[model samples]
Target: MHQIKSKLLLTGAAVIVAFSFGLNANAARMDMVDVSNNNGYMSTAEYVSMRNEFGVKAVTVKISEGGTYKDPYAASNIANVQAAGLYINGYHFARYATKAQAIAEADFAGQTAKAAGLPVGAVLATDVESQEANNQTKTTNDRNNTAFMQEIAKFGYRSDIYTSGSWANNKMTIKGKTGWIASYPYVATGKNWYSTNHAWQWSSTAKFRISYGGFDVSQLNSTYYTADQKSSVKPTDPSAVHQNNQTANKHQQANSSAKWVKESKTYTLKTAVKLRTGASTSSSVITTLPAETTVKTDQAIIQGGYRWVRQPRFSGYGYLATGPANNTLEYVKISVSNTYYTVKSGDSWWSIAQRNGLSMYSLAHQNGKSIYSTIYPGNKLQIN
Candidate 1:
């Protein structure tokens, strides 16, 4: 009788250990959800509630082509989700119109994601589905898919392609990046999309579980939250508000600089225009120049100004009257450098500086400009 009791006790202990192991395994899996088209633009409060309740680990928000209509909740929603301590990734619905179009669409989505300040774990995913007729155009679709992912990679974030098991295995051949396989047991036939994957969306309703994926799985529901959640957290950068104001100011400056008038003049001097005599004597001279003149332009000597010359009678050096200084001849009347820049749509002084491998402050200094200086499309900028 005693031996029977010992056996029963051992069996009960084994069961308890097995249950504990299962619970531990569940905690390790990555619990995620595809918020693609499912939530019809949830409000901040709704998002917060979902995070607080569900323990959702990650969310994949859908970004449509052309980004003509982005998730209204994207930026703020990401902030709220991050505040609730959840990971967020962006998914682009491939339009498959053209390779260029697909690339453009992905660019727009990546820009939006970066602008939202989504930190680590925010990847740009390409959502490949069979509904689009272009899906049959395997070559075109494949080309577009590859190009789109490449564009997303440029913005310092990883790329992923999200498709069903069968579509991923049979139709797509994404070479470099990871895949987020959509395997709904009810609908999916294949078991896994790839031998190596960064994530897997096994079922929409699956609870968050710890899987092979490094992150913890999120449970599906309105109340999902992740391990990253915290309460009443403020933005890391206190200067963000000030920086935003500064950006606005710089944008205004760019517009103002773009408005400057380029006039043809036959100055006795061969060099580009400098301030007219005493231009800085008072606010009057500075104000007289078209609003296109950059704000806080340096009084130091440099080449290039508001005037250009098509033809010159003499090529030899000659003295030209520059703006007012203690000595009229303070600035050397040297010819302007032909290196000029025509502003592009998203061109910023900082961006230009980065492209040219120049420091923002140094570029501004060399150009006799300020950080707040404005530039615009078609505006000619002197680059010496």
Candidate 2:
């Protein structure tokens, strides 16, 4: 089965399931619900109702910790969300000094989240920035975070990453994992995938009363997901489809003319648009995009009285319907050289360099890490 993703630029039509809803509603929330152990332990029958009443369609529950300790109240909180029939998700607070530590924590987090009722289509994220780089270089710390995310992916769930925008851009290896950006006051655009924030977390306010404690609310923008992904946990191993194409290349938007007539193009959405499963309007909506959304396409097709742009894989939704005559999605910039590698167990700088036919010093220097430093399994390495 295809992997469930929550990234800005996922590749492949069958593998992407993300949420890309921007165009904020002033001060109101326009996305999912994310709570934690800090929200207190309560078994309120209104857990689901209150969320539904507030327009909450999904819930992100904290399951594991920055270390190995499980969230004390995660099970109860998860049960309430599950019992309430809300979409289920979970995250781990990362606290890793080594690649091994990150994997162990990811294993613990995945197991805990699974037992606590994490659903199939739901995402498991590594909450970085908590001791993410205690004594190590930023590269080492980023490897840990990437390893944590990769280990979580091994358990069958799609992976996401949570951290500040500055940290993500300047300090971490954020290629493989989809971004769940935390930026207060919400920045409209950044260096990541979206022109705006993808899965933007707007606040940590304690104003919303939930169950036995207060909950934090967030907003979704420039990202979206599908219902099948939100379904209960299943036996489908997303690793089945794992490859270099799983994540979008930040260096280049690959494969134009595969869908669109052009190789790299851009467009804007004037209205809320839906990606249809087929070229016809009557086809099922694959995903929905917010207004003013900007996306890149290499192809377009005319059908159902609408001009549909072929979506680059992992750009969240596919086949964006552009009605605004001014709407245009084109490629703007390209990086120097986009090269990467996913670390495997027992792999190190020397081994990676030798295997890839790269010089040890060059590889280390390219990734901004020392040759003597530790590289974790599941983290993606920038080769050149």
Candidate 3:
């Protein structure tokens, strides 16, 4: 839970006991990224971008780890930062302790960052701490950190080693690699703190509340950044960035603009899933919706790796599992009891009926059309 920038002064025998601090009382030039898992949500992005407010300059995100440790919503978070016009960088929670292991992690981090289209200038930081090394001696930690930083250079990106300031000064050798210190709220004063330090992670929580996306808060120093790093990554709106084409989210505008003729639509839940009190999995579970159970949703959004839908009379979104284990949930759109549907691309009477849980025979009958009739994209289906 730390970020970067700061200075320290003291050398020789007295270095450990006496060191200087540098604090920028004016945070106007400072940038912030609340470091935490809460960033998995995009509401933070929309909140920050309102009125073109440049409250922060950049955001840091998790990119990869040893196994399937990739952040589920990393892409969404990155896209949100881009839409907010903020510089985007990423870090990996280190799991390796040896040079070979560190190299492998760096390779994974490089590939993941590349696939995500992270800006070239954004620093790829490595989170190396005592726990990452299992409380190994400083000698072993120094060798691994040095090797990891050098390997990251192969990816054509600058690298910074994130460690506690105490470790930077007293525990290990950090001379070759750029240092990002994670000493919180203990701003050093006077006499120009350590000049080698490039960033200061000053707070985990304070001031603005929404930025607390479950992460520590820190600001980066421009001195350690390149001109390109300052360029805000302008990404497409996060709502539209998806690697898969889910039918439920297609041509969403038609429904967005369509006038609702009914209060709710019937949907058959093809598989069992949880109906939570809120959109996120962190929300309390209202009930476990069993397989083949009928569920209804008036509103839905892609969030927290699932389609959080608002069931009828529910105060908030209910979590619907989108993972492989329970992904058979379907949004049935049938022409039942005077229901009408605006045609969408590739939509037909049979397809529409099937999608909505209506019998093809009954759907064609209510719409005043034969089974062989053709329905254009814009045609409206009225089932009475």
Q: Which candidate wins on TM-score?
A: 2
How far residue 141's Cα lies from its native spot in candidate 3, in Å, is: 1.6
- Across 195-219, the per-residue lDDT of candidate 3 in tens digits comes to 4566666443233333321234454
Model 2 over residues 133-221: C-alpha lDDT tens digits?
42357788777877887788777676777776556655575553257765443222232332244365544422332343224445554
Decide which is better by lDDT, 1 or 2: 2
Candidate 2 residue spans exceeding 4 A from truth: 1-24, 27-30, 132-134, 175-177, 186-197, 209-214, 222-384
Give the Cα lDDT of each candidate. 0.43, 0.53, 0.50
Off by over 4 Å in 3: 1-30, 34-38, 47-54, 186-195, 207-214, 225-384
**Alpha carbon deviation, residue 261, candidate 1 (Å):** 68
Weakest lDDT window of 10 consecutive positions for candidate 1: 10-19
Better of 2 and 3 by TM-score: 2
What TM-score do all the candidates reach, one by one?
0.42, 0.49, 0.48
Per-residue lDDT over 1-384 for candidate 1, one digit per residue giving the tens place of the 0 to 100 score: 001111111111100011111222212222355553223344445434333333234566665545465665566656554554445566776655578777788778777777765443346678775234122455767777878878877765556676655556456764433566654333222233233555555433232122111111222211111211323423233243223223322332332232222323212332233233331111122112221222222122211211111221233222222321111221223224335567799988767754442335445666677656786798776553
